[model samples]
Target chain A: MNATQSLRQDVPEQGGRRPGGHGAAAPRPRPGADRDSAYWWEAVGEGRFLVQYCADCRTPRFPAREVCAVCLSLEWEWREGTGTGTVDGWTVTRRTFHPAFEAPYTVLRVALDDGPALYCWGCLVGADPDGLRRGRPVEAVFTDVGPDPADGGPTGGGAFTRVVDWRLRE
Target chain B: MAGTGLSGAAALAGVGATPLSRDSGVSTTALACRAILAALDDAGLGVGDVDGIATHRVGDSSPPWVVGPALGITDPAWHLDQFGGGGVSHAVIGQAALAVAAGVADVVVCYRAINARSEFRMGGQGRAPAGAFDLQYQAPYGLLAPVQHYAVPARAHMQAYGTTHEHLGAIAVRQRAHAAANPRALKRDPITLDDYLASPWISEPFRLLDCCLETDGACALVATSAERARDLRRPPVDIAAAAWAGGHSTYSPPAPGGLGDDLTTSSAARLAPRLYAMAGLGPDDVDVAELYDCFTWTVVVQLEDYGFCRKGEGGPFAASEALGIGGELPVNTHGGFLSEGYVHGINHVAEAVGQLRGDAGPRQVDGAEVALSTGQPGHILAGTSALLLTAGR
Candidate 1:
């Protein structure tokens, strides 16, 4: 009757490759950056993308959490990256139970060198579908759809409209 | 009967559900209400007679308060909410029975509904925004989605037992085949093991068809006192034995000694002996079963967990063709959550009631008096709750 076992199973491995990956590759949780995540959103507002990093460990953070998961460091700084990442895995959704995501949308899990693996909505910028493979290079392309006004800003109106929640650069 | 001012004297007098389907084109709220009203009506009780209600917490639905009044309940004397684990629903049902048995209320209804169609467009994850708690474990490795979370265990199950992917596919092959005959099922057409393997991969080891269909619907039951149940409209099916627990024998958080890691036992294995003792029957006594099938591999897991098959034998045991009609035991006659709609385990219970009542035309087990329904949500392991509802209890 250990009540703890009643909780959800499947605590993800901190990072890939088991033991060594735990050294520093703990993934940054989503909406990861604290109040400053507004910047990530603001950046998205301008067709630009950014991620938080531990000022100490230089580990990239995602989903914008308050503190760095790796060193438990609260100190973080925002930085620009090449919207580039590697595909770890992907799924093409055919049937949808929800309305927001139209079917056939591809959800990909990509990896950045210092950050933990990241899962996000992705669109292949320009490549043959047959060539898709794990570890293949990918770069994020601003949807150019612009920032969502409901997202604490103006409707599709921004210099760059940091659109990709998390996208590959190329 | 945990001595909470309630002596566990409750009994299941009635059960009901609307026609099961992927999309009724009805609001989930309406779906919930319909099931509640139908259960009440089946018990020869009116909505006003129910004092308490329990739901699986289908997303975006009104709370018990709003649901009760909308269904014409004047002032419910009892209202219960249970979630966070698939097994919690059965525990709550037993608790409601205890409540009614203790005279806390005359009738208590347990139900669940979901616009899963609109909420879980992807079975891998739901509409819930990522939280700090879950994100810590999930967002990394892109394991944020539940399907992938469950895949870990399924993979371990494969690795530990040498169970082949085709072995898992056998479950799908049998289940959907049965679902094809079930008039109320969503995917009534047949699917082959080849179809399952040929299906596109969804997070590896899991194919598009290996998952349960996203559905919108509801199911409910009216549990009353055994004495009062005899006088109800439909025959009152006595809940002979009901029990629920959170962990297995020698349990641990990460599953001590990797035994729990094998996916063979936990929550269910620990609960099986108690359930058999309570029901006064062995696994051999069950004539029909409706184990949860959120995933095909899960059915094999529960088959072993519930003691229907040995721990390491689930894959091979389930591989035998004896599961369907003309098999050793008829199972998932309602097509299970795989082919039938997923309303938590409520639909399984309703289908069990039908089998016991001999109302399941083509899918019915000839004199099915003993039925078992079990579940595990998000790896939240709460053991089994067995109901021995006989034609004569």
Candidate 2:
């Protein structure tokens, strides 16, 4: 299978276990997608990173909004991102608050390169956490998570839905 | 610099709080009533005199409707139950002040009661409800706690200004020293910088000591017209000014063309001038300050945003002797949320009132005249509120 296909087929094990055996993990909480953000989650399920742009002002925004904060325009459209960004800030979770997440995972705040000033948060994957620094260039990767029982059923078409993860750029 | 017309129109007559503790072993309603009654007694007012009630909460505490009648306030002229955390602590006071000034209510009591440790703990399970629209973006990645949300900006501040963990540790250590003298402080044991550094990391860049204690307690303040305040038992702390500002939500996208550079800056930067303009006071006039200390970094950022020091210099400013009781500008003299209990910033207001009224026994700043008390500094929610208070002559 192609790399993309293999990634698509990867479904997280029960309880959403991380690679390192810290212990038994709890099921990761599912994203509560509403009407505004349901489409974005669908795109992520297909391994595409999408950002919403004001149709009139052409300003990009995230976390789904009804009107443009700049121009107050109702017009907007979704555009795929370049999956590339710079690390604006980051933190290492030494203590886990949620049972689903294991300790020692790095969470990154990335300022996307495709948009003028967009930023997103995700767990760091396939990269050394120590290498993370301000302005470090990074790219996104898609990972499949469970058909969570908390979600009742699959959000996407299949049994798993994809979420964004980050890795340092070569 | 138009005045808010709220300057000196209302005065905080009294402030009261339950003893800060790990477990109160009572319902939130009981805690609220105890604080409200104490504040009324402090103000020399009867329960029948309270025509207004204002409070803010995050699905953790009792509301006005429940606490109002329990206190024998049958027909409140005005009531507010704002939904938020530390962001609205001062806004409730501001709203109550406006209500009294506008003649909508004669006596307004602002209180916050939370069993944050024993019940509805912050960063605990089910704290972020399923419908919290903003959590959709963050919770999936295990960014559910305030420490995680705040750590991002703490890291950003460290990166831009070369701020060190030692600088953050200095705040923790100093505040603990202050708490050592505060009888009501939860963590009164003095901590050294060595102790601060040795504390385990809750979120990297944020050691266990960098965060505030989650305690179970309640705090209340009484606001009335300046005339009524003079008749009260305790010396009034006039509400010289109140200002609240809301910026882009931290979880939402930054404004167009606005890079993450604004991350290091906070809503305090936008509202400080307005707060001062309303008060007709400058930073130099502030004899003592009770800034929100949800995290050590917040104190560092607000010290700069409030014009106490230059931007990017809060690190060194925080580490300096300026924060001590006898320093140029004593801050969080009641130990703040760092050393004192976190009653969701309302306790900070109580501490400020104590300083202004000369009721603070040992940790008080000598001859404090004007005080600045603030809510959350807007790092997490981009919403902040503050009050400028002057001692009644």
Quick one: best DockQ, which candidate? 2
Tens digits of per-residue lDDT, candidate 1, B74-138, equal 57888876644356656667777767866788889888777667554433354433423323223
Worst ten in a row by lDDT for model 1 chain B: B248-257
lDDT of 2 by residue, B1-393 (tens): 234669999999978788888899999999999999999999999898899998999889999999999988878999999998888889999999999999999999999999998998887555533324666667677787889878988898998999899999999999998999899998888889999999999988999999999899999999999898998899988999999987535654555443234688888888899899998889999999999998899999999999999989999999999999999999889888988899998998898899998888988799999999998877565488999999986
Q: What DockQ does candidate 1 score?
A: 0.07
Best by lDDT: 2
Going through the candidates in order, the fraction of native interface contacts each one reproduces equals 0.06, 0.72
* Candidate DockQ scores, in order: 0.07, 0.53
Each model's total of backbone clashes: 34, 0
* Per-residue accuracy of model 1 over A1-170 as CA lDDT, tens digit each: 11112100111211112221112222112222234345665675455657677799776666566676567888988787656677654544344323333333344545544344443334332333344555666665543332222333222222322234233335
Runs of candidate 2 with Cα error greater than 4 angstroms are A1-24, A152-160, B1-4, B126-131, B251-261
